[model samples]
Target: MAAVVTALVLLVFLAGYRFYARYVGRTIFKDDDPNFVTPAHEFSDGGDFVPTKRAILFGHHFTSVAGAAPIIGPCVAAYWGWLPALLWVVIGTVFMGAVHDYGALVVSAREKGRSVADIAAKVISPRVRLMFLVFIMVLSWLVLAVFAMAIAGLFMAIPTSVLPVNISIVVAVVMGWLLYKRGVPPLIPSLVALVLLYVFVYLGTKMPISLTDVGLDEAASSQTWIIGLFVYSAVASLLPVWLLLQPRDYVNSHQLVVGLGLLFLGLFVAHPNFDAPAVRMSEEGAPAMFPFLFVTIACGAISGFHGLVASGTTSKQLDSLEDARPIGYGSMLGEGALALASTMAAVAGISLVAACKLPGQGEVLDLSWAVYYDSWAHASGNKAAAFVLGGAAFLGKLGLSPLLAQTLMAVLVISFAATSLDTATRIERLIVAEIGEAVGVKALSNPIVATLVGIVPAYFLATAKISNGAGEAKEVAWALWPVFGASNQMIASLTLLVLALYFWQRKRPILPLLIPMFFVMVVTLISLFMHLVSFWTTKNWTLLAMTVVLVSLLLWMGAESLLAFTRGREQPDSGD
Candidate 1:
């Protein structure tokens, strides 16, 4: 009876969410003109501002924001039970994430297709833009560094995990390069690349590599990978969009859709119940339930990162103002759906007790999944579950065992780190160049010099961070996680502020933005303060360094934003 009621409630909630989003789409995004060509019509010079179809733009926006973090965070949170995690995912997405993502896109589009950085400068102030850019770059670096370590750890842990990712990256790059640079049709090459990637995935699983003997751990290895990745990112971001980010993201977007579909289907069929407590969180937890959940599940709930993607990339591609509603707003709902799907999977599959048993183990074990399957098998007393378990047991025969899955999962976990790292480097370089021009630093204006200055310092810092850790093989996950969460939530809160400002400017009800803004900010600030206090007491230099960067950046952003608003009110506006 309990299970039936729970299932029914979930069904209704998901159904309503989908319906509401669909209604939003029809009313706001449907195009009346049959002759309307998107990127073809709006502007066609193969630059940043080229327009695109709403559907394709939605693809871009969704893919950029959706990644492995959703899977990991929800799975971790599921240790408490599905109820709280699911609740937050739904509420945060509908109220917080969707609002920020959609609003950013609309606001950016209406302003003649400027990047968020530029928009911040105009709508807020230049100081705000500068501070926001710095924060973003730093946040980007942190993300990339952490993930690089994760990916490298996976490679060292089980070399076979590298097969699918490497093959996928290569296929994506080649396909994108051919399509955009050589004038080849994207459809054919993309399909071929995807097919090849899948083939590699299967083969890679069938034949795996073992690297446990390697000295590198998840933490140390990710730092090494970050250094290398940053150098590559520096080169990649500077290149034409078609070369790397777009094409790779295009392939990634499709994989995301397919992967998510398969994952959800499998979970639904399984329909496993979580065995964790309704409120299993500890008061002394580094990332405690209340505030930490908000940051950890940012994209799945409300990510500030989405705003950057919407304004920086997607808005420039919008064909009309109306398309913004669906592509921007609808994609957010889709991401929320994805988060819910993952949360459901975690809850349905894993037992809570097994998940809780991990921190004591002192390693990032693949606990959630193992427990879920084991429990379901125990409950049903099914031979099919036994076979699956046995298959996992023998996975080591091909080196495609549980360890390999962890390695692969960890690698995939940090893919965003690479994306954010070099992306940050480029943004920083741009800022430095702008500063140079502003202050008349003749040598600083040189792109080459600015690029070096930006990439070189971060590279060294990343290397030091990895080496200073407890051990080369021991991944330092606990220390940095809180800061990462706080940074992401801070961004989400800032975005909501932007939304509130926009509505306020137009004299519309600001509740939509204000409410979410307040919720995220309060939660995130609590998290930040807790993190700072914890690190300060411990005198952990590495954590202290990261906390300092985060606090300083956030403080500057706040001051700049307040001053901008004050200045705006003081100046005589077009509307008295």
Candidate 2:
């Protein structure tokens, strides 16, 4: 019953978003005045901002948001039951992520493709700008650290993880050389690199790269990975976007579309019952809801992180105000769809396993329950379901036979993690450099020096694995969870805050900003309080560290907002 409802809801949501975005594209942006010179047009350069086809822009924007974090979050949160994760993905994306992303792009574009920090400074006040700057830097560092650890965890599980990643990187470098160095059109090498990437995943999975036996002390391994990822990010960020970022994105974009499509098609055909309960009530009688679920499923629903992407790169790529609706709002809808698919897979997988389990049997659902269930029941499903499920059931039934699908999933996730980690590191570097310059630290004004300084935190958090010990390593996951979620939520808050300011200053109806702003604030505050209480009660040093980081950030943001209020200014508008 729940499964049917979920499917219906997901379909309706996807279809509605498609209809709505098209309506917005046609009606709201009907003016189509190229000379009007909105922010995207204002900063128009042939490189990033020039009008490109919508398909290409969609590919770019989608890849920026599509990644393993969404899958991992859904999977983890589903342990509490699919209800929270599923409902949030639907509600939050529609109301929170979609609105925040679209709003950020529109606001940033209106401000001349300047960054969110810049807009905050120019329109709001220098103080607000500083807070945003600091937020960007700290958030970037934390994000880098989190993803670095995630990627390293994978590599640690399978040493051969490095092979596909290295191959993809090499392929990218070579493709960049061909397109940029040898003056070849991007399409040729881009396709080749992409094909080679899949081939590597296929072949590499069969090569027996499991290194679980040769464990590096978790701490040591984590530290090494953090430092290594920092160095990698520094180099990657410094490179021209054409070389690595753009090409990799091109490849990843296709992967997301194809991969997500396959998963959803399979889930529908399988129509597999969802075994997880509607809600998981904790033993203590708490609802096991609210703050925890909201924090856990941040990326799928309402990630503040999306604000950074919208305000940073996507804003720079918009061709005109018209593009903002699709690039921002449309892309978020895609993410929401992905989240729904993941939740379906989790539920279906869980259901299949629980049904087959014998009475008094040992626990049926382990951490890898989805993998196990898909391995068995995919082949056991009704002929109709199996046939309808298409390639998903075929792949699922294949188990470790083809090995390619598993490898593909693994490589896709790892590469996404690597790219995101590096990107975060670069953003941090830029933030530190900008902030240092603002504070008159002339010596730290060098981007490279600021980047190096930024890397320090990455190294520290990454290496904290060893120093904290194996036990501590696992615990940090929980402690850091809310901080990561809150940081992302705060980003959303700041974005909606900016949008509200924009509307307020312009005397436009402020309901859009007010709606999302209120929700994010409530959720984030609830999540933050839970985290603080958890940290203080446990007296865990890792949690303690995260608490300090959050506190300091809040303080800085408060001061910055106070400064903005004092300034009593309105952003200058050059009417188009």
Candidate 3:
């Protein structure tokens, strides 16, 4: 049954990519433009805007967007059930996420690689564009905060991951130097880098390093990791794309492919039965599946962040407009595949016994569906850890040593988080600079200052302590996760609106884009409302105020978009 389900999901994804995605690209995007000059070639600087091959760009785009969010979201949403999460991921990726990402890429490529918010200024009102940029900045900041703490939490939980995660950065610099500076062919050098990364992975398992081992307690170690991560982000943000960002993401993409392959192989071999319930009742203290499921599993299905990556960086490096389908649409499917694998791991690989055990508990618990769901429903701290534990368990079924398997899983999680952290920081820097230029703040227009402005708030947010209900304090990342989900989906909603308006002005078919736009706005608005109620009940004014602002922005954008639609105003000739 498990094998059949997995096979069906893969088949559906393949069919969608071949038929549906192709249809949307041809009919709606009108993707084949022989005369279209991509920005990478038009603005060739050998720096951030150099033309890149489809494969390398795909690798960079895929890894940047396939962060820990997809894994964590699906794992936590397993509280509702695996079936719902799986269905949403598969279907949403096809109809919603792929469309949004592909549209953003195509539109940005058409507009000289400006971001969606920048494009909004041409298609929508200037006021709408300002609000949209603010929305992107806030969303990117939360992403940086959440992902940094996520990587830190993983480091503390699985100390062996610390070595390989850091070493991969050095390996990326070497790969970049060989490929860009030395003008070496990519295939052999990238392969060599892959081998070197795993060599360190093995070494890390054998001689694990951790701040805790050096005498700091767990809390202190986590803070240290968070500090180190922000410092790395600041440096990475200032570097040329080819130097660190592109090469590092390229390596991480390969890591993702290998890790995903092993996970599916383990699934086929083990064929572990699904242990979690198919659905949870409303009485479980979890929000109903309607809106919550959509927000909870944002990336796997449809994420606004993909749009940022699409227009902000990917579009600038596109070799040709023709490659947008595979790089943009196809990457969303790749992320969906990862989300499905996470669901399988959580549902089948993690046994009830293991889920129920206390931290540091030594006894092995019995495997049962009921016990698994109950324990999973109540598991605490960085739900990503659950997926890591489950993935390690699945690999162990293939006869690997438990310690080795756990270390590999931890490395995978941390690497994904680190890739996202840097990418978000870079995007946030762009947003800050753009905002500064628009508002006449010359000081904030400096790249270094913009990068620091982006990182500092995220750092404080990640390290901020809040009461954990038992008198002890905890990192705010986990507490702010729901807010992140809502904000992320809100961005998706706004991006879709931009795309819809673009299509409307072009006199092309807008139904395909409009449907997803409407669906996402509805889901995001409701999710925010629910969060507002929760915050009000708990007297959490910070989140309450944030929610209010997001809701207001959504309404404001929605009203303006509606008026534009009703007016049927032609797009400015400048946009064309």
Candidate 4:
């Protein structure tokens, strides 16, 4: 069953890429001219706007957009059932996620590599640009906070991942120096980096450094990790992309390919059966799967965040206009593959090992998914660990030891998260710069000032605590997580609105984008409204207020979009 699911997903994605992706690029967007100069070349500064190879840029884009969300989201959504999760990732990815990402990259490149929010100004109106900028600001801010918190927590849980994740930074720096300064060919250095990376993975399993070793207690250690991660974020965010961000992400992408390949091979060999149900209409304590599922599985299917990554970084690095088709559309399909692996690891891979958990229930387990996911709390809490353990078990079938396999999987997860952490910080700086320019804060346009303005709030937001109603304090970041998903999906919807308008004005095919645009907007809005009612009922004022603000932004963007279609339909295209 696991092997069958894997094969089917691969086939579908290939067909989508071969046919749908090509059509969307050629017919729908009117295939970009190769002779046109890209922003990467037009504004080359040995920094953010360095022109890059197609394959290398794809790696950076894929790893930046992927992060741990794809793995974590599907694992959590699997509580509803594997089938729904599978279907959403396959369909949402091809139609909405890829299209939105591709369109954003193409549009941004044409607009001189500005972000989607900036493109909104040209596609719609100036006021809409300010509104969209603020919306992206909040979303990117939360991403930095949430992903920082997440990776730091993972370091604590999977200590063996610590060394490898950190060392990759040094490796990336060297790789970049060689490629840019010494004019070294990428293939050999990247290959050597991969080997050295696995060596550290083995060393990590043996040494497994922790802040506790330096005398910090558990709580202090967690805080220390978060602080250290932010420091890295700041430095990486400020540095030249060739020095660290690009090469590091490039290495991390190769790691995922090898790691995912092993998991798929193991699935064919072990061929585990699903221990969870096929379609779970309702779980006892979980939210209804309808709108929740769409938001929960954001990265796998569709996400607004991908648009930020595409327009923010990838567009600035593109070698030519034609590269947008592959780097924008192709990367999302790669992410969809990762999402598929995550869903399988959750439902079928978990059943391959042997462990006992439910005390007093005589649930003497043989590593069954049913026992582990018997409750929503258990499944949700163990989302990251679920993938690591299950993928490790699958790899064990291929003769890797438990310790090595787990360490490798954990390192893979942390690497992706850390890549995103720094990338988001870099983009946050750009978003802050744009916001500052919009609001007339000239000082904030300085890169140093913008970096601080963007990342400082995320640190506080990551560590902010609120009452859990039992006199116990809990993370406000986690508290606002439900609304975060709604906001994220809402951004994707708005980006699609921008894309649809971009195509509508050009007299090109818009229905392909229009269909998914309406579907995602409706689903995310309904999801937000549901959470609004739930927060109101529970009297969670903090979350209620946050949701209210997001709702307002959605309405504002919707109005802007309507006027663009109804009143601004004759707006001329920004011809390059």
Candidate 5:
């Protein structure tokens, strides 16, 4: 059954890429004419906007958009059952998610590499530009906080991940120097970096490091790790994209393959069945699955965050307009594959654990999944532990030791998370700089100040003392996750809105684009309203205020969109 499911998903994804993606690219976007100027060539700054190979750019784009959200979301959403999450991850990526990402990349490249937020006013209405920018900047803060906490939590969970995660940065910086400064090609440097990275992955299991190794308490150590992460992200974001971001991400991009390849190969060998239910009716006080499930599994399915990456960073580095199909659409498909592996790992991967735990056959399988799921109260933030155990057990089938397999899986998870964490920081810094320039705040225009604006708040939130819903005060998670999910999808829907308008203005058939836009918009609005009520009753002021601002922006943008649509592509939308 596991093998069958895996094969079916692979086949479906291949079909989606081969037919649907190609169809959308050729006709809708009108990319058949390849003679065009890209931002990388037109505005080659040698730093942020240099033309890059699609392979290297794919590394940056894919790893950046696909942090740990795909893992964390499906793992947590196992509360709803694997089927719902799996369906969303697979179907959504091929249709809504890939198109959204591809459209954003293609559109932004056309507009000379502006952010989606930057294009809001032109396509929607003038009032939208500032509100959209603020909304995106706020969303960037949430991204930074969530990923920062995740990486730190993983470090605490797998202390062995620290050495390799940190070492990748050094290797990346060295490779950046060689590739750019010394005129070396990326093939040799990236390959060598990958080997050295895996070597350290093995070494990391042998020489684990944490603040606790010195004198810090566990909580203090987690706090310190979070602080250290932001510091590194701040510096890394301030550096040139090619210097640290590109080489590191290019290497990490390859890591995604080796890591994902192992888990998929393990699935076939282990052949674990679906231990979790097909559809979990309810889970005590869990939020209704309809909207929350969609929001929760954003990255693996369809994420607005990908729009940000596509337009914000990826668009700037697009070497050719034609690469959007492969880089933009293809990268999203890759993320969907990751999500599928995560979903199957959460459900069937329990078989590997059940063989050792329970006595019976039928009930034992179900019980194993329950054991992993029931530990939710204690394991909500570190739910990656479930994926880690299941994946390691899968790897154990291939003759690897439990310890080594666990270490390998942990490194894979953290490597992607760290890549995303810093990439988000870089985007956040750019957003901050944009916000500052718009507001005439010369101090905010400074890269360092702009970074701190987002980073400091993220640090505070990551280390804050908050209720983890079980009355115990755990750190880092269950805070901004809901807000992030809601706003992230909203960004996606809004991007779709912009794309829909772009097509409408050009007199292209827009039904295909509008389908996903309306669907995501309605669901996200419903989810936000529901969460907003909860935030009010609980007096979660930070999230409450953030949600309120986002809702306000949503309403404002909605009004602008209405006017723009009614005005029929003329008259400046009549004094909006």
Candidate 6:
């Protein structure tokens, strides 16, 4: 019953949203500009501006945005129970996430494929553009740091995932060479690469490798993995899109489909009952569901990060305006479906044994929803581990060997995180270079220099340590997760505000964009305020400062936008 209900809920919303998206594209955005030349075609160099097919570009856009955050957020938010997580993911995706993403794509595409930050200067004011760019840079830094640590943690925790993840990179390079340089058909080569990837998955399960087995302590091993990942990101960021980014993401998209298909099939075959409660009272010292849930489950619902991917990367490669509806709106709903699958796993598969261990309370005796919520809330950086356990349980119920199932699940998570880490680094490099040119910094415009500038700060942050509630030191990524959610949602609100202004300028209906922008602004500000209080109480000065800066930027940009809307000054259009 639970599995059936979950599947139906996702399928229904997806179907309805597909139709709604088409309507919005036709009516509001007037997105069928067949005569309009896309950036890819207009500036067709043999580089980043290559006109891409809808299918390949969709794969890149989807994988780049749908990272481990979606999975981790829903799994943690299940603390309030599946109902709240499910509702928010579905409603937020259709109204908020998809709108934000699609609007960014359409707006950027119309404006010569510039980023939302770049368009902000033309739409609002130069000051707002500077602030927005700074906010995005900081956000990208946090994303890179968090994901790098996440992949490192998984490598150390699930040793079997390391080989397949590394092998996929080589396979991606080969696929890129064949498809782009050699001019081979994409379908057969991509499919063959995916099959070889799974072959590594099987071999990984049988002959798993571990860093600790080579005589390094856990901490040392984790650091080694982080260093290795940053090096990979640096190299990968410098390569041409067709060489690595596009091909790797294309392969990963197939992995996503296969993984989701298997998980859904297991749900039907196993039909696991919902063991977690429907809703639980907020525990002391824990984030409540109202504001925090919206911020917590960001990527599955609405992520400001998606705006960057849509405008920064996807817009530059679109072959036609019609691709925006499917690449932007469709990818977001695909992420929403992933979030729903995560919610089902958290509620149905994870139970007492997989629960969190509360500090100073050796082991929980009751093993109820309260216990699980407390455990998950505190397990910040490692929350994805619980999802892995639950996913493994699902496979076990389908009669797969427990070891193989766990190994496969670990591989899935690691692959997702690695793709996101490198993609983020690439985006950051672009942002850094843009900022350099804006500020007249000559060295910063070089790709190698810009890539180093982005990776260095993230590496320092990832390796930094902070004091936990128990006065013990923990990785900075774990300490920053709460603040990261607020920062991300703040970006989303700002992006929405920009989109609303774009609609107003065009004399189109602005209600749809305005409504979501207002709701997100309120939710995000409240969450940031709550975080301010929490950070101050814990004397966590670093995060307190970050919250202050983020909140200030949001208000500053919000005020500027408000003034523009109220005055109704129609600025001269920058010719596209």
TM-score of each: 0.77, 0.82, 0.95, 0.97, 0.94, 0.95
Residue 74 CA displacement from its true place in model 4, Å: 0.3
Q: Give the per-residue lDDT digits (tens) of candidate 3, residues 498-564.
A: 8888877877787888888888888888888888888888777766776788788878877876777
Once superposed on the true structure, which residue ranges of model 4 sit more than 4 Å away at CA? Answer: 356-366, 468-472, 568-576
Provide the lowest-lDDT 10-residue window in model 1. Answer: 379-388
Per TM-score, what order, best first? 4, 3, 6, 5, 2, 1
Q: Against the true structure, candidate 4 has what lDDT?
A: 0.86
Tens-place lDDT digits, model 4, residues 487-526: 8888898899898888788778789888998999899899
* Cα error of candidate 2 at position 568, Å: 7.9
State model 6's lDDT.
Answer: 0.81
Residue 216 lDDT (model 4):
87
| Model 5 TM-score (2 dp) | 0.94
lDDT of 1 at 139: 60
Against the unseen true structure, what C-alpha lDDT does each candidate score? 0.58, 0.62, 0.82, 0.86, 0.81, 0.81
- Please write out the lDDT profile of model 6 over residues 1-576, one tens digit for every residue: 668778787776677566878777876777887777888888877666778888899889998898999988987888877788888998899888998999899888888788888988877888887788778887888898888888887887777888889999999999999998899989999999999998998888877889899899988998999999999999987887888889898999899888877877888887877777778756775667789888888899999999999888888899999889999998998888878878877787665223434323566444333444555445343477557777777777777776677777877777777877888888888888778877889898899999998899888879998775447786676677777777788788888888888778877777778888889889988988988888789887777887788788888998998888875646435432
lDDT of 2 at 53: 44
Our model 2 lands, by Cα RMSD against the true structure, at 6.2
Estimate, for each residue in 1-576, the C-alpha lDDT of model 5 and write its tens digit.
Answer: 877888898899999989998888876786555777889999999878989998999999988877888887887777777788778888799999999999999889888898887888778776788888888877777778778877877788778888988899999999999998999989999999999998998898899987787999987887788888899988988898999999998998899988889899999998877888888865666677888889877888899889988988898898888889989989998899888878777788865753332211234233367776664342254366667778788888888887788888888888888888888887787788777777788898788898898798777767776763344564443566676687788888888989888767766667778998899999999999998888788766666776787788887887787677875654322111
Q: What is the lDDT of candidate 1?
A: 0.58
Return whichever of 2 and 3 wins on lDDT: 3
| Stretch of 10 with least lDDT, candidate 6 | 352-361
Task: List candidate 6 segments past 4 Å from native.
Answer: 351-382, 468-470, 569-576
Q: Per-residue lDDT tens digits of candidate 1, residues 421-512?
A: 44445455665665565457888767678777666655554445342233332234334655776788888788767655654554555676
* Stretches of model 5 off by over 4 angstroms after superposition: 354-367, 375-382, 466-477, 536-545, 570-576
Candidate 4 structure, TM-score to reference: 0.97
